[model samples]
Target: MTRDNDTERRRPDVRTSLDQWLDSRRGVLRKGIAASTAFTLGASAATGAASAQQDAPFGAVEFQNQTSDGTTVVVDSAILERGGFVTIHDGRLFEGQVTGSVIGVSDYVEPGGADHLTIDLFDVPGAQFDQSQLQNTQPLVAMPH
Candidate 1:
């Protein structure tokens, strides 16, 4: 009768050990799934940002001139720089062709006085823009065109 009771006790112990092992494996699988999901989401976000940057309409510096003559001149930030293409949205400047090089940045201030960023536009001849015209202008958008 003592031997029979001992066998019964050992059987329960073995079953408990097996259950613990299975639970540990399930925990490991859950962790692996979480890690994989995080990696996939991170990669997708990075790719989206890169594609948007490539399609961005604005550059480091954009020029907007509203003339009293009812002509508006929109210049691409890159074209104002040497050997770069500036996209002209309206009437031309400097010639009927309307393209210029960006020479440098100077006296840039944050858009909303938020102390965030300052940007200056310059011509290839080293002439800096006053940037006062942009004060009343609408804030630039971050979305790509």
Candidate 2:
């Protein structure tokens, strides 16, 4: 994972920039803070800046560590400046970096915010990687793309 320290927050025109932003921060779940909180807020703020002038692309996701049925995940909130999707990963924090693989993904969301969003797990058919159901004991990350 990489940290985006750039003070100038410009709207990215490609998915790679969003990927970089999502990978920018990785931290252990601390008391009162979710692991993906920083990135979520950062992404919101970055896109918020651009939105101030126009309808700029933005994305943010925030959720608490919670129990799951191993078949789905419910995100507390997700905001996409444009149409996009959210992904759930079997993420773990190692040396302040996240490492894991995507395990689930939500269907295409319309441009706006969603709460209590439930995403079905491992529904991709003929996937090349492991498609096992999510585990309750597994650390997870909810990322918007």
Judged by TM-score, which candidate is best? 2
Badly placed stretches (over 4 Å) of model 1 are: 1-58, 68-82, 90-145
Worst 10 residues of 1 by lDDT: 136-145
Q: Which digits, one per residue and each the tens of the lDDT, describe model 1 over residues 58-124?
A: 2233333333222223333321111223222112222322223222232332232211122322332
How displaced is residue 78 in candidate 1, in Å? 4.7
Candidate 1 accuracy as TM-score: 0.17
The alpha-carbon deviation from the true structure for residue 27 of candidate 2, after best TM-score superposition, in angstroms, is 9.4
lDDT (Cα, 0-100) at 42 in candidate 2: 48
**TM-scores for the candidates:** 0.17, 0.53
- Count clashing residue pairs in model 1: 4
On lDDT, the leading prediction is 2
Error of 1 at 17 (Å): 52
RMSD, one per candidate, in order: 21.7, 13.0
**Clashing residue pair totals per candidate (backbone < 3 A):** 4, 0
